[model samples]
Target: FAALARLAAELPPALAVLVGFVDRERRGERTLLFNAVALVRGGVVEQVFHKRLLPTYDVFDEDRYFESGARPLVFDAGGVRFGVTICEDAWNDVDGPLRAHYDVDPVADCVTAGAQVLLNLAASPFTLKKRGLRPAMFAGIARKHARPVVCVNQVGGNDDLIFDGTSAVFGPDGSLWARAPSFQEQVLVVDLAPAQRVAEVPASDEAAALDALVLGTRDYAYKCGFRLAVIGLSGGVDSALVACIAARALGPERVLGVAMPTRYSSEHSRRDAQALAEALGIAYRVIDIDPVFQRHLDALGPSLDALGAPGATDVTWENVQARIRGTTVMAISNRFGHLLLTTGNKSEIAVGYCTLYGDMAGGLAVISDLPKTFVYKVAAEVNRQAGRFLIPENTLTKPPSAELRPNQLDA
Candidate 1:
């Protein structure tokens, strides 16, 4: 309580605020309860409101820790009366009579109690399509009540639940005002004017998605205690794109591109790999793997013969080459304590197109989730920013091939 008082005294005033959840039991009772909403000013907490509804079905266990509070919590800050709701409160229609049987009516109780703004604090988990629906739902709520609403979501990966913390605000007219990036923890400040209608603004959805991936990569690498990234430079579009993204996210010097060519590697591929490393300004190393390939073939000669000469085909031969490159990259990673980056794209990862322990070998797969179509787009974007063709134009235009045999393209 003393800490809360001191904090309230030092903090700036806001209309409505939420503190962390409190796990407690009611006085003289053994039942556990989770308190939901709290109003804070400066550093002091003014009031604590327990959640009125709890959900306990697939993936939710809120009822195990919460006793519902029946009434809405209304507080005033910065000349605005705000109504507060915890995660599951607004999710249920029975919490308030006005909200029953309607998507936006429960907020009526807050307005009746003199709340001019609605603030919802949530820790919603991520799904493939849930992100697309959240903004629209909030906008509908705001429009129905003719009041601005602010949503603050918890962010980070907790077990299987990944909170895509893109907190947002909507105007009285149900138009989005500001939105934080997804999958990241961010503090977003929104200026709200009473009865102001939000105007439709152009949004860069692709940019936002790309930024999320970039942030995820950066955080995963840095937070997991990795400073250096190693990429196999095959002079193919996929690897080139991964190299570009890694350089941008973790700085050029932190990224190392290795070009491992064999007897079957095309001259164009070698030249292109060198060009890409120079263009990205990252350190590049050329390690000829012909000797290693020969050693592997000799070691597996008896088995190859037993398997009816499987190594004689172009596909088998290409896979051998890929495994050799994978081995070389892993060796460097082990020696220097760097994170090996796999450059396979989504199109390949799908339908089991990628080799399991070959090109797919890496500590991190940068573009493994990105489709080949998107790979080209992002690579083009990188080049567009560079103001010149840093990735050889031929590399982008050429059909992708494993280059394990003469004149063979990846099917």
Candidate 2:
């Protein structure tokens, strides 16, 4: 807090900075830590307030860190009593899913303490449903309390969690004053006048999803020190979607598409992979696994003598082909120092339809969270967003297949 106060002292006198950080205070004889937001002005820290509510669900484990504050923080600022809350403080409502867990509604408590406006500093991560749901939730809170609400949410990706920074302002009558863009950073300055409402057009679900994926991929690679990406192009929707995301995330020049074709590989699949790579203007290469695959068969033939080593007809041989393709991609990843992207979808992974070390081998599973059905939807959105057939039409219309065996289909 002192360091932040010192930094705040350097700012212009007209501007006040609200900074969130860990604060240490003396309680009795023991020093305790708190998750606090400090209001700084006049070359010093004017006031500081702790986060009252701490969530301990999903990726959050606030209880394991600093202690929760005992009371709400309501202070006078610019002739208005501004009520302050942290991320989890505003999450608990009488009508919410966590109604039974807590005995407090921070927003209501703030209003009870004579607050005219509410400000929530949040770091909420992005999800498919939550993107649209947050505004409605905040608007409801504002209407219920009859106070204008401002929520400034963090934006950017940190590992697997992606924060879509859609900071917004809602009037006391539940009118939207302003809304920042998703997955991007912008300084939003909205006048408190009730007459100046910006008519914001919400992004479609597919459009929001595409932005999320692109931001996630870009942040994950850049944060992990990866400048290039590589993908195993199976000529299927899942791999195609991943490839398109990679192209957009880390420019087409930084992406490599590899197709490891074997005897069971279809001609159309090879063509589709090449065409998709070409359409994206990414690097394309084809590797035939016949030599290494046949050597593996020859070396393991004696061990499988009792288990019927009937050439490539055995069920276990299917896994071998997938593993060879996996190895082919990983080898390229190692040689080029690229981030390898896996192409398995949620449905296939849930039912254990994919091989263990085969299709699952990669630094990142780009489309693993998307189900087979949703994968197709996003793939279409990719083309629609481009206003052209970036992914070939046949790839979308054709039946899904792994092509690990001759005349094979995922069905």
RMSD per model, one decimal = 5.3, 2.4
lDDT of the candidates, in the order given: 0.74, 0.85
Question: Residue 228 lDDT in model 2?
Answer: 96
lDDT per residue, candidate 2, 158-204, as tens digits? 88788998888999888888877778888877887665445343367
lDDT of 1 at 22: 70
Q: Give the lowest summed-lDDT range of ten residues in model 1.
A: 93-102
lDDT of 1 by residue, 281-308 (tens): 9999999999988987888777877877
What is the lDDT for 103 in model 2?
75
Query: Once superposed on the true structure, which residue ranges of model 1 sit more than 4 Å away at CA?
Result: 1-17, 20-38, 42-74, 85-114, 122-133, 153-166, 176-189, 194-206, 307-317
